[model samples]
Target: MINVFFDKVEFFANNKELIKLIISNKRDKKSDLKKVIIKLIELKTELKLSFAYNHNTKDITKNFGINEGIILIQNLLKTDFFNADLFSTNETVQLISNKNNKVKIKTTEPTFKAIPKLNHDRIKKQRIFTQNNIYLQELGIISQNGKIKKDKHDKFRQINKYLETIESLLQESYWFTSGKPVTNLRIVDMGSGKGYLTFALYDFLTNSLNLDVEIIGVEFRQELVDKCNVIAKKSGFKNLKFEQGTIEKSEFKRIDILIALHACDTATDDAIYKGITHNSELIIVAPCCQKQIRKQLNLTNEMAAILKFGILKERQAELLTDGIRALILEAYGYKTKVFEFISTEHTPKNVMVTGTKISQKKNNSEILEKINSIKSFYGIEYHYLEKLLNNLSV
Candidate 1:
């Protein structure tokens, strides 16, 4: 029998015991090792997994001489996994476990040289957003000493994912036009709760990307508005401010970017309406509640079987509502995309809808017709977004 052992097995709480038993027993059985390699990859938000002692590892070790590679382990959603040549003398390994826990492991070569130290610790590359950032520190994502707070890790990752989305949007050519640099930009964020993203965006636009921009965050809660305003003033974010107001009543002369994250139900429609009316270069929203469409949905008898379940029906309504919203944006000459902004494990409502206004634009009658057809098929009599557009046109 091969005795296998894993490094840091006692420390990792998640899937740690299973991993320890597999590796610790094989450590002493050097001749029986058969060049085994273990590789762990990130699959989903909640599932942390490890692979070892299988034929897959045996075959790979036999062929490649190097047996293990661990790519992005923690926060797998945002990072990429790579095959690490653990046996190579020149290889460098980085490990990230919990924010407070870090250790360097020394190992002997060849048989177990390529085997990664099995721990809950995840290896991360250069981060898109750093804990040392002042805004992150002020936001409580990190401690005063510039270490990520244990409780705030998820919030930190969520903020990074949001920034990644914004960065991607900036990279796309649809927002840049007339072969000119976009020096002047104005952004409006509707329902900016606690203003996490609002402040981060300001920091990124001004400090990182170095763009001249003004960002306004609208929140109905006066307390949150005041708090965020104070932070902005303290941070010397001259172009960033939070205002107390509803999305519908807030006035805007011009908007380059419009963001409405987790605005409940019809409020998302209002945000979209404001974006379309102002001809915002980019519109990004993450809608929540979706109660309006759920109330109005009347599935056909044939379709009722699956949708008859209350939970399923609610989900269907949510999808239909956003799907229609995207179609409407397309009708208005905006190229739109809908995707998961973050994993459902962090927040259940994670889908993001993004639209970028484009030139060479023509009214897409086909999308409008499809919208109407979908509405009729689902027995939906009214969609708030469509009604708002129709009322405006009238």
Candidate 2:
């Protein structure tokens, strides 16, 4: 029976008709893996199998040649999985096995034609925002001929990377994964300089994903705000608009996703505070200029010798600043992450701090204690984010 399944798979592979294969019902109940899916993909005129391992927490995918894919399927079916479903262009085959080692094979005509798409280059072909997009051209990231401008290549990459990060976060959310309708979704971009990322995000969510979203870009300069508003109108982005306001002084309604990139000095703290106060589901910020912490540092500990150097002191301040911010967010019921947003080659300020609201209660006292210890070790008086959050009425 197992050999029969392999033969059928091989027959489909030979004719390039195999569409997808799913293996399930893990023989080992202790395994963390839930199931595995394999799909036929054409790469550069050659057929390959894209194997996706769906685990309880995450999914991993890899590509293999047709012959290699068949071998892998056979091995998994024999050792790991008890049930398999194979779909081809014309037929569907199901192999089911019981704990008694008895196997049953069922074959039927496919309900619908399952055609594989040519995916020669996944990254370039599957970008959220394409080169020929009107917003991209209007933003000067791409030329009218649909080619990325040489000078704006890094900016283009940064925009896509930002969108990718946001997309992944949305994918992990309950509303997205459960296929629930997220109506009246509101997003705010603080310190939106020139509205580059702001426009790209609106385009991706509304046009690409078909989500009903309203985005507001807040810029301090009135001229950039007006310019962005014009581009938004010209591009037919009806739900997207910009307003002139400073991060600290701006009035934000309830925001689902709050983004503030390159907010200088304590402005990043102001953004995070606003996000928290407004009950934002996700807070994203890229901080610039750690001058606040550098001014407050008065280290007399052993690390003071190393901090004596101006550059090292500045670097330490940046690390400590973002680190404390992450801790403060965790104290406020958010799962936080701090990482590099882009390469230094593109821009010097690359670190990004993100916080996604979580339902589970965190140990606020312990988190605050750790923050205090770090502050004491560095001879720091306080973090700006801490100061802002402290003043919030509970």
Candidate 3:
């Protein structure tokens, strides 16, 4: 059985169609070496194998010729590894080992296509926003010489990550996938301070994805609004514009995607309320300065002991505030997720909350009961988002 598996591997490798091979499920439990990932990389004149040694905590990579790679894989499989998965452009093959040392092989259709540039340097070049991007230059994230500024490296990564998230969400969205064809998409960015991410999203959707999109960046400061508008015009983003207004006061006829990052205090709640009221398909926000819940806390139960510490109390408030917000969104018939938007090293207030509208019918009583139970445990009166939603009905 092992010889048969080796014959299959040699066939794919010799044919130059082998994409990747993952050998895992260590037979030696005490070994720190975890798994081995091998991929075919095309060099200037020849194809070579890139072997990545994944350890318990670190990873190491080395390149080898095809024959040498096969030998190394055979040696590892005979001793250290018990299972293997091989991927090609056309199909995938899995090899499993039983307790009796018998091997079983299975084949299925391919899950991913081959990427020949398997090196670390080439992987860095695959970012969504490259250094030469016009918006990166305009936003001062990159220099005129097409180099990213040292100070803006984290900002650049954050922008790319944000756009990557948006792209993934769009691919999964019902409206984007199987719904009626959309000739145009409308997006609103509430409290868009400098329009950094707003411009990035517009560029990605319109230029990269080649979709018809109209984006509005709402800012309370007229200066920022004017500045972003000028940049949009100079950048030739015709449908993108900025408006001077607060999240609470801003009005939009339609919104397909609503984004509000780093909105302070109850302002995040205001943005969520706006998205819910407009029935936006997607809502994303990174909440900041969660002081409202801290001020309203009436803790007198077992948690009151932990609430004695000012810092711990502040953190608890932030957690409860976002938790209730997610529950409230679920009550409104939206699927919700709360996670870190970026690393704490980049910014302390990095928590992000998102809601994707799933159904028109809401689970009001059930979700509300859960929300009230949480509020009661924390000795809180109400969540700001719940209040806005409640007042909307009245």
Instruction: Please report, in order, the local distance difference test score of every candidate based on alpha carbons.
Output: 0.68, 0.84, 0.83
Local accuracy of candidate 3 as per-residue lDDT tens digits, 1-394: 6777777777777777687899999999899999999887766656678889999899998888888888999888889989999987667889998556788999898765432233323433343455556667877888888888999989887887787777767756775555345567899999998988999888877766667889999999999899899889888889999999899999889988999999899999999999999999999999989999999898889989989999999999999999888888888888898988778898787788899999988659988888888889888897888888886651
Q: lDDT per residue, candidate 1, 250-356, as tens digits?
A: 99899889999999999999999999988888999999999999998887767878888999999999999999999988888788999999999888989999998
* Model 2 TM-score (2 dp): 0.74
Window of ten residues with lowest summed lDDT in model 1 = 1-10
TM-scores of the candidates are: 0.67, 0.74, 0.74
Q: Write the per-residue lDDT of candidate 2 for residues 60-135, one digit (tens) a residue.
A: 9899998899999888877888999988877999999877878899999984363433452363334555555777
Candidate 3 segments exceeding 4 Å error: 1-23, 26-33, 36-82, 85-94, 97-132, 175-183, 207-212, 391-394
Model 2 root-mean-square deviation = 8.7
Which pairs clash (backbone N, Cα, C closer than 3 Å) in model 2?
none
Instruction: For candidate 1, give the lDDT of residue 231.
Output: 89
Backbone clash numbers for all candidates listed: 12, 0, 0
